[model samples]
Target: MNKLLFIALCAASGTTCAQTPATNPMPDGSRDMYVGLGVQSAPRWDGTGSRKVSALPVLQVQWSNGLFISGMSAGMHLSTDPVIEYGPLLAVQPGRDASGTGRSADGVGTYGPSLIGPVPEPLAKFDARPTRLDGMDKIGTRLTGGVFANYYVTPQWRLTSSLLYGAGNDHDGARLDLGVQRLAVDLGGQHHVSLSAGVAVANRNYNQTYFGVTAAEAARSRFTRYDAGGGLQDAHVGVRWNWAWSPSWMLTSNVQAKRLLGSADKSPLAERSTNLTVSTAIAYRF
Candidate 1:
């Protein structure tokens, strides 16, 4: 196992999952990894007020070759500079069905095929619950390509941005995320906390697929027809705490709050414009 270290940040929202790992300088041919499971409570869907609890799987890894995978995202670090980092990125955008968003607590879904293969939606029993997406069309899982760049003013503060394309039912959707983070603040003993706040901007195709109600959809669903334009989709703030119990064991917990913006907040399917997602997991290093 690699030395005890903490070096990743990931935030999830209705529209996107942002995974940003700090650059780690490790020995050649070595790696650091963590894998575990936990639970998460989040809204049934993006705009729904109802919430559901499901299993949460934790996976984070970084190799000596400038490659890393955190949560559902994978990317390579091409910059050697200590102050700035940039590289190509690829991510799996979960699909959506009548029940809710394809990704469950464990990051599995079944609306369509994932480029990496599906993990099979587990909480299907939750389908019995009513959701605003009941009569909506199924959106396929998408493999999005993008780039990520981060600027560090110091080791503890960073500015982050990423642009990803290829989402939505038609696969023409795109999103850009911008945020600032205060990372790894020691709070006595083995506890550490990190904070972040960001905003996501999306294109018309993306917003429409997730929020708009077409005439046909309105006819079938309870919602009235509505058009959602491209713009700022949501703003979010998050905090994460890590408690290291040993060289190989640690508990990680996170809480995030998001509020829909612009047209996304006005969609008929949006029962609530604001929501919170909370999760906790225990991981073992390898």
Candidate 2:
């Protein structure tokens, strides 16, 4: 439930991509792999304040040694204690700068190019308003690597935390997340429900790169100049459901609500602080 894992919703694949490992541990000599497709609604830009829906792929692999891959993240387990899981973490932090330019599988824009673009113009303009907010500087993807720690207080209660440092030039800043999760898995393994609540923090550089407006940007976007500082960026809660339809087939879905915090909430680009994201996918396990 780390808020930094998605770009304005579903930009790459068909859905917003976020994966929380399943409740059961892997059998010592076996592995479990799940592949899913989900859709999530996110802000139009990194602080744009408005939201749209996008779909993306989801996957998670848990192997013998506690090594796991979940969506855009992978890490190794450092502890043998069944109650606590922690180790090195590597992840991709999604970035954004487009004003609805994201594409979907049909080769059309995610929000539909007809209303935005795939062309040289704005489809809808409000008294010369759309032109001013037409374009933006592109934000490249970032590769982040760091440490992750999680504690399981009980079979159904968990605490998750992570710290990552960005390696990409796009937004070379650090990010941190702290969250708690609760999972309910039926003894028959036929159903599952999960809830997670967390908050994410970004450093000054990260905040500025994504939310700050330089003079040139102000001139281009027509938004007044604004400088953003680092601190708590977002707080979110997620509710997920899973159903095992058969021995190897499963279905999953989730809804997440996120609210901008601190400077991220006050940025001129923000339209609203509360963004609701939802996703669903059918997956397979072997």
Report, for every candidate in turn, its global Cα lDDT versus the true structure.
0.72, 0.55
Residue range with the least summed lDDT across 10 consecutive positions in model 2: 106-115
Question: Candidate 1: misplaced stretches above 4 Å?
Answer: 1-10, 104-132
Specify the highest-lDDT model's number. 1
Candidate 2 lDDT for residue 146: 84
Number of clashing residue pairs, candidate 2: 6
Question: Best TM-score goes to which candidate?
Answer: 1
User: Would you estimate the TM-scores of all the predictions?
Assistant: 0.88, 0.78
Write one digit per residue (lDDT tens) for candidate 2, span 126-189.
2345322444465566667888777777766677777788732554777677777665544355
- Candidate 1: residue 250 lDDT (0-100): 88
**Cα lDDT, model 2, residue 216:** 79
Query: What pairs collide in candidate 1?
Result: none
